[model samples]
Target: MKLRRFFCLFLSVACLGGIAQAQDDAASLQEVAQRREAQLADALERLRTLRNDIEAQQIPLAQRLQDLDAQIRERQREVERRQRIRDNQSVELDTLRQRVSDRQRELDYISRTLLPEYFANYDASLSAGERATAGEDVRQYNLFLEKPDTSETDRLQHSLALLRDSWAQLESRLGGKRYAGEALDPEGRVISGRFVQTGPLLYFAADQGELAGLAEETTALNATVTPLSTSQNAHIVEVAQAGRGTLPVDPSLGNALAIEQTRDSLTEHLEKGGIWVYPILLFALAATLVAILKIFQVYRIRHPQPMAIHDIVKALRAGQRDEAMRLARSQPEPAREMLVAAVEHSDESVEMVEEVMYESMLSTQPRLERFLNVIAVTASAAPLLGLLGTVTGIIKTFRLMTVFGAGDPKPLISGISEALITTELGLVLAIPALVLHAMLSRKVAGVMARLEKASVAFLNGLSRKSLNQKAS
Candidate 1:
């Protein structure tokens, strides 16, 4: 029993040793696992920190890229704006240059058309007249008496006239059929409608709203004035008389017909007084008539009772107050006004009297310049009216073209003709009106100067009389 008890004790001691060894092994494994877990956690923390840094860097990079793109877009817009400004400026400069070039070309064309060698000769002749008038004894003073050797010019004129007839012939062939019921033209010397055979003269109802006289007073002139014919002796007088009724209808014969038709149409239009040109022309005529009548009236007043300074001085020296007043009343214009004012200032001082006379002269000057503004207005407005008429005619022509597509030239040419005729007439009227305005203005100035001179002379006489009286 003691041995068995000793064996049990040994077994218990071995089991205890085994359990202790197992516990130590488990403790070592746990230590190794904890070390590995700690290292892994540190590595994971490092990776997370690196990921956050990368994300932060990406945000800044994205912002920088967006800012760079915005800068580039702004630069492009600025460049485009500058380019547009430059383009607009260039276009404006080009337009201005083109307008200047066109104006220069127009001026050149006008100068070339109007100024020829013959124009130079005419200018030289005019200069010669001016030189003679300026008291420079000109050699060409009698140029008007000397017959001008115009043979070449006359030949050219004759050829031009023949060419005009040929043009008329061609025009008649193209447009004569349209003008069947037209009246005769007084200026064109055409006999087409309303012909009346009087003894030697062939009276006709003309385009002028009045009867037209025969083309010529002499029978010999009638033969030459007739239109060209194609007979064997068409140029001969005898042939013209023999072949008057039996001649073929040459193209030249249609010249009169076409001209008469156009003249009749134009005359009918003008007589209607519907165009602006007609009223303008009537106004100009009325103005011119009034100006002429005023000129005649002024001439009558000026020539009959001219007040001379010497006569007035003698009257003042003689102390003939009643005679001076009578002379002043008989005188006209500035002289009468000055004398009346001077006589009214008998009790006044010499300076006061002189001032009164000057004031009176100044007041009369405006009266002398009466109707001058109207002339100036007419001269200035005439050209504008012409431009208006031209514009109207051009508009009418363009309107006709829009409707007709330039199919017929009659209406178009008629408008152009009216435009040209009215323009020419306006220029003609305006040029003369301007000249008359200048002349009248100069005359008024001269009259004012004469009145001032007379006033000065009277003042001098009064001063002399006062000094003499003081000395006495």
Candidate 2:
């Protein structure tokens, strides 16, 4: 029994030892499991923290990307706006170019239309009438063919005055009956005798075989139903009063022929009417064209920028001498030249600067006066030329009278009318041109004076600056 008990105890101790070892192993495993679980929890926490960080970073990155997209859209809009502006500007530029081209074409057409060729036919017609009328009147007969501007009417009127003043001169020249004495009534009745200082009073025999008185009586009798009546008398008067060659008719032409020629010439003048209007229209066109050209040139020079003296002055006062010079060189004028002079003498004495400015003014004076004398001459000559044309017309009419006996007064009257019309046209052209020339000249002088004043002031201001610097 003792042996048995001892064996059992050994077994129990072995079993207990095994159980304790197992328990210890289980405790070690449990500890290892707890540590692994804590490590996993830590890993999970780290994963969650990384996820939160990523999400936060994503929000900022997304926001940044959205901002970038908005910026890109904004840039596109800006580009579009700029493009639209450029497109609009291009369209406007094209439209302006087209308008300019059309205007140029219109101007060219107008210029061609207004040329003298178009009106030459009309002038020829008027000239024909003028040629027919100049012959009958004594005044008309005297005119020279070389100069037609002095009309038959003008000559007649002049000669009539002359004849009235000195009847002896007409009788000696014209071979007309000299009535030193005697006067007749319009009814073929003798009114009185003209007192002759040297001899018996001369009387004119009337168509009724009655003696007509001279002087007033002869004039009164001749005033009506006389072959050489009012027109003839007028012609005689004109021839007597005027310069010798200026008379349209030959005083030598019989009194009847003179009167008849005057009437015929007047009739012919009416038929040809176009001559007077065409020249006037053409001249006006030419003047207008010249004015337009001048205006165009002025507009061309004045556009984009204006030459402002005030701006130049500002530049000068600022001591920006180079800028001032550049500005002055932009235009050719008294003001620019004076400004340049002042800038050149920036350091000079005030008096010296003033003298320099004065020199500039004198230099520009001739330029201001340029073409003004020509304009004045043209103004004076236009009317004279018109008068000459009228005289020529009259001469032509008188020449016709010599060729064709005065059957009708129409041509002669027409010629006289044309001469008068030409004279009037000349005055019309000359007066306005002269006035415009004077006005333009005055304006140029005024502008030049202003330039001089401005220049003086600028120089004074510059010299003052120098003086101040010296004082300093």
Candidate 3:
């Protein structure tokens, strides 16, 4: 019990000590709370000061921000107006550029195509004499267009001048115009001559009256004069001097002259047919020779009379074998050969006799058909040669066009015309060849048929005769 009481006493003492410590902690906490409350009051007073300062500044700040916002909106509106103006200017600029481009295209067409074409046509229309004067102007106009620094205005102005001059020249030439120019005489010397031009016709007369005739352009600027008769030359000189006499007018203009100039004799025409024409002509000659030979040979072939054949059969049937043989020998050579063979083989059977005569016909077949293939080959080869010539001509024309251009169709036309001449020659040669071949072949066939007919007639005579007397 005493121990229990002591423990209780100690517990009480510990509890009291705990109580005192708790009280001390409470006091210190109170002190801390009071100090914190003072700090809070100081903080709240500073906050009120800061709030008042901020509020004082906020009014002017807000007013400045509002002014800045108004300024920004005004600047944005001004920028929008500037942008609209810039867009409108862009449209106008594009329209003006388009107009400039369109005008440039028109200028290009005028300078490159239309004006050049006009000048070229005008140049073509100029006479050889007029070309002496107008050719310089046309050349100058061409140079103007070709110049890099030449302006559109200058080009157009020069073009107008050229066209005006060309038109004036044409009009003056239509009535009649006399000009002094250089002309190529027939002697190949250039002579100073007076030229009389009327429309498409141009004439030249040497100052000495030694040379005068129709003037033809050998080149764009050069004229070659074809001297007329001596009497006509005097007349041309008189006309060229007076400018009022009759100018010999060719209704066909230069056409008649051109035709006359192009004219060739048969020999010359054949020569111009080129190298292949020789072989073609050789074939023609060979075919012609063979045809003549064949025709003559065919003509010589026998046509045995029916009555002549009957007499031999009569003699053979009447036991006059020698007389029959004589009669057979008297027949034409082709028939005589076969008849002799048949008579020599008369002792044989009828089949043997027919075979012998047929063999004889076969032997003579080569002679009858001799050289016929040559004619046929010529007929077949002529057109091929012509076609070959045509191909070569086309090739030549293309080659010339490659070396020179096709600006002048004369080379192309002349080449084609010369090329077609070979074809013409070929057709001409082939047609007659084919016809003669047919006719000759027909004659040979007729002769062969006659031989066969004679053989058949002789064989029939043998059939009607006695087989018993054939041993002789």
Q: Could you give the C-alpha RMSD of every candidate to the true structure, in order shown?
A: 30.0, 46.2, 13.0
lDDT of 2 at 387: 74
After aligning candidate 2 to the native by TM-score, how far in Å is the CA of 141 from where it should be? 48
Residue-wise C-alpha lDDT for candidate 1, range 1-472, written one tens digit per residue: 9999999999999999999999999999999999999999999999999999999899999999999999999999999999999999999999999999998776555443433333344333321112222112222222321346635445345434433543453354332111112232434454333322222222222333333322222222121122233342232222223322222233442355457645656566553322767756875986697578557644544521333555655676577877767766666775777777886674478999988988897787767777777777888887878778778778888988998778889768767756666676678788888888887777777777777777777788777777776898
What's model 3's overall lDDT? 0.84
Candidate 2 total steric clashes: 83
Better of 1 and 3 by TM-score: 3
Evaluate all candidate structures by whole-model CA lDDT and list the values in order. Answer: 0.59, 0.56, 0.84
lDDT measured at residue 292 in model 3 versus the true structure, 0 to 100: 87
* TM-score of each predicted structure versus truth: 0.44, 0.35, 0.57
Q: Which ten residues in a row have the lowest lDDT in candidate 3?
A: 463-472
lDDT of 3 by residue, 376-421 (tens): 9898899989888888878888988987798988767656755887
The order of the candidates by TM-score, greatest first, is 3, 1, 2
What number of clashing residue pairs does each candidate have, in the order they appear?
Answer: 0, 83, 0
